[model samples]
Target: MMITNNPPVLNDTAILNIARDVLDIESTALSELKAQLDENFVHAVRTILSCKGRLVVSGMGKSGHIARKIAATFASTGTPSFFVHPGEASHGDLGMITEDDVMLALSNSGKSDELMAILPFLKRYGTRLIAMTGDSTSPMAKLADVHLLVKVNKEACPMNLAPTASTTAALALGDALAVALLKLHGFNEEDFARSHPGGALGKRLLTYVRDVMRTGDEIPSVVLGSSLTTALLEISRKRMGMTAVVDETQKVLGILTDGDVRRLFEKDVDVRTLVIDDAMHRAPHTISPDALAVSAVQLLDTHHINQVLVTDEQGVLLGALNVHDLFAAKVM
Candidate 1:
């Protein structure tokens, strides 16, 4: 009988050790990248900032994946940018680029034929070229307006043929560039939130008190000197768990809550005999119509109350809202 050769099987310890080694190698490569930040990086950032048009990122293979992520980071951080495949650039996609635009190219070997083919077209169109590569002496790097060094000492693969450490270094460098530009442009959290309005952070940042508060006839309120019975009826009719006590001019005087009613009952006093001004809590927490809805939610939580009055600068009641309103608006 003839027996076939079998592949070697790795034990648990060997598998774990290989994984640890890969992580260690990638970590060291990142450390090296931090040290490689120099004047060339500054020049690249300056070129991108000075460009009048959008930034166009292009790469091949693994570099293409990293390039797409970099483009997204830049766009979300207030920089206008998009990615183009090098292969497609040679086709009709090159028309997407213009003379005013800047091109950011990624190539682990610094010698991707697809990218090299479009280099001349970019140059002829007067588009600035920023190359991220491992080989500073390669033709692509030498031809670039600015070269960002992303070289790695070794690959994580045992054969040293895969683009592992080099790709990580390139991705880190791209992130660095994006963050630097973000700061340079004074991009703040609000700007980022605006770009991502569908996200939770965006909702919290962009939602204002006026956007969620119950306005017009929806607001539950009683005029000053109104009987506690009248106030209670208004609260029950509005179903907001409370009612605002306002003056003749609609200026907020105080707020009466369910807790206040409970306390009043505990006192064994006839609530019908008291006026709303006597039972309502003075100096109640109030929010401005221009304030963020998140602020209203925080006020409700901090004061341990279920409702708050929305007022204008003149202290006039503009609207009212409860914890439920905030929940319905997804502000909580």
Candidate 2:
């Protein structure tokens, strides 16, 4: 039998077929992980949840990379966690682990020497261990208080000897565990935002109008009977594009903007003697200082307004915001 040296030329269909095959194999592996998520998985979750100290994840090589990602996901989602390289653990880093901490060990073969070498110390210290391995019968699995099996029938690599399929399976399992732990801990959006203060989602979830809006003395506010000139000066002084026209009780009665003054000029209205009420737009829409900036964005879009007055529940002026403010805060 002769093996053909010349393989068929690749085509779009062949490329798509290869991609589909890889996805199918990985999908099958993930389905297997889901099927195998039994009582042991729940036990692992319970152990981590009940741990008084942080979750310490330890692994070697490729498993170490996945372990670090898993640790980050856990920390950002509400569970306190950090990753520890097994090679370093024997070199004084083992001091980082405590009886209060739970160790999550990752090994494809369940027999990494660096990870195994510290097991005796971990056990002596009475620290709980959760093992993730491809082999359920391996020593690490047997020694662990809880073992999560990430078994894959074959690798997605064409040579059938790489970590592709196994790593994908492990990553999916780690995500599942993190989501489960999040639900178990009742982690909410606010909690997640607190952990991620530098991102867009963090700003959206954690930032209230009060945190970003120009407040109090920074606001351009004029009495309800003030002249349009005074209102314009207030708007210019505060640079908020508009001024809130308030009554004697400091309750917002209307809003005066450069646009309103421009309209008065176009209609030949007296600018010098015209009170703010004569030139003001009454019952202008307003937002609460506690409202989400995203809500202010929606209101701005819907009403075609450049600015909105920020008020308390009793219609008292508290602050003001404009599209520029949203832009400055990156909320836009």
Candidate 3:
């Protein structure tokens, strides 16, 4: 007989209980942190708001990881900030700090050796300090112009030694700070899109019809008196699946699509004898070139049409775009 290679299975209820216990502990820590917020929290925000220079956040070990994310949040949401590891700042990185800058130091114990080593130098240099720590009486807290206490009742770790719940609370508080500052500074979606121009959201919010519409010779269009066959040829040549029918002033009169051609064929109509007037869709859907690309998508979806004409305020045809254009721009 050979020993079985099957792995031991955990009790489902026990495994779920452990996971839920961790979440409950962390959630409780956040609620307590909310209750603990007082004038100190206000002073921290005020100090950063009045600052003429950047916010330089520093921490050590696990707390340092949280501080880096906090710094990134601040930077992206209108507050100029970056992380400096306390260990590195104790060495030559200390020169990066300036009296005009505000230093935000994170240390759960408030007694990190590297951080403590730089506090006196920072004090002497006259850089305003904001400290986030568990101990209000610790040297880091005592030296800070404003102390935002992040004292959690306990860690989520079963051993109660890891920086689990405390780190979660710190991260949440940092997010609260960033969000408050951006709102106070009147940051909007356009501002956020500018900050994230390379992402899909940027494509949706920043792209305009003028930026992607086909103009000049690329526009598939036919004159008002052109034959249906001429319109079809123009559509095929431009590869847009539709052609705009325009008058003498280049004002759009109607649109003739491949779908219309197919329907006309199904009705046994004499296509060779027809003009654009007989085949074109009157007053076809149109959009403004200045409108956002996403608005064109909404028009297409609302009308159940794949192509839309771009027009100026006076109803003169400017250009055109289709669903494929928005897709290429990642606006769809």
Candidate 4:
């Protein structure tokens, strides 16, 4: 018998090389997809744009996972969409499909049994079909009113059978479709923020101090001539680490923080008789209530101040912000 020799072991470098090969293959597949964009892609987008009802996405296995993610991307980016497993659709989920809805199906081989089983039912419902497949002549593509060809050169898997490059190509195609529609609809960052209110981008873009900051009775404010004792009470009541020293017109003059109070204590200053101006930091950094929370974070970092007083362009005191407020808003 002839003995065959192969690499003896897998080391970290070998593993990393394998990873790089997979990434390179997938990257090439996606880049190839960009050149294939043509009138067919445009028709697909137009069909989806004209859709009055929800978009129903379906696939099997790895394609199913990508379909679910694509559905989520569509839903969050101004297009109303959801994913329905192809197998589930055959069982009972088909009831979710309606005449007004558009169906999007994904199949690497273009002939998944589960997906094929539902084609008749979808056609019967008069639902338009958009197919994403590797072969345009495949059954699913033939049945589709619009077929998006995602033919990839090869799989990134060493076995050349596993779904890797194909899936990446499909994912990139889905993103391209969603973003194209988003731009056509003129979706802006504010609209995106509305869709993802819990995320950091949303907080950085949409959050304003007036939406998260203490104001009116909750805001710690003391007159310039007020005694340090009164300022301390204001600070304690608000618990915002600082109090704004303002003139009688409610225009901010300075700020008195816990650090200033500690300094006063070290100096054995008389709180009852000393005015707020005697202990406050003059020319304190401030912002407008309309300023984004991210901007406030920048101010805090630049001046090394934990709190920032919000004022109008006329310099009238409006509200305040602290590092805690930025934390709570997720702007930090």
Candidate 3 stretches greater than 4 Å from native: 1-9
What is candidate 1's lDDT per residue for 1-332, written digit by digit as tens? 66588857999999999999999999999999999889999999999999899999999999999999999999999899999999998999999999999999999889999999998889988999999999999888998999998999999998999889888889999999999999999999889989999988899889999999999999999998999999989988999988999899999899998778889999998998999988988897899999999989888888888888999988999999888888888879
Candidate 3, residues 201-254, lDDT tens digits: the string is 888989999999999999999989898888878988999989999999999999
- Those runs of model 2 whose alpha carbons end farther than 4 Å from true positions after fitting are 1-13, 225-237, 257-279, 292-294, 301-304
Clashes of 2: 0
Estimate, for each residue in 1-332, the C-alpha lDDT of model 2 and write its tens digit. Answer: 99869877899999999999999999999888888889998898999999999999888998999999999999999889999999999998999999999999999999999999998799889999999999999999999999999999988999988788899988888888899999999999889988889999888887778878898699889997787788888988998788998988889999988887777789997788877777787988999988889889999999898999999899998888999988888878
Instruction: Judging by TM-score against the true structure, name the best candidate.
Output: 3
Pairs of residues at least 3 apart in sequence or in different chains that clash in candidate 4: none
Please report the TM-score between candidate 3 and the true structure. 0.90
Write down the worst ten-residue block by lDDT for model 2: 269-278
Candidate 4 yields a Cα-based lDDT of 0.91
Q: Roughly what TM-score does model 4 have, to 2 decimal places?
A: 0.83
Each candidate's clash count: 0, 0, 0, 0
The lDDT of each candidate is 0.92, 0.90, 0.93, 0.91
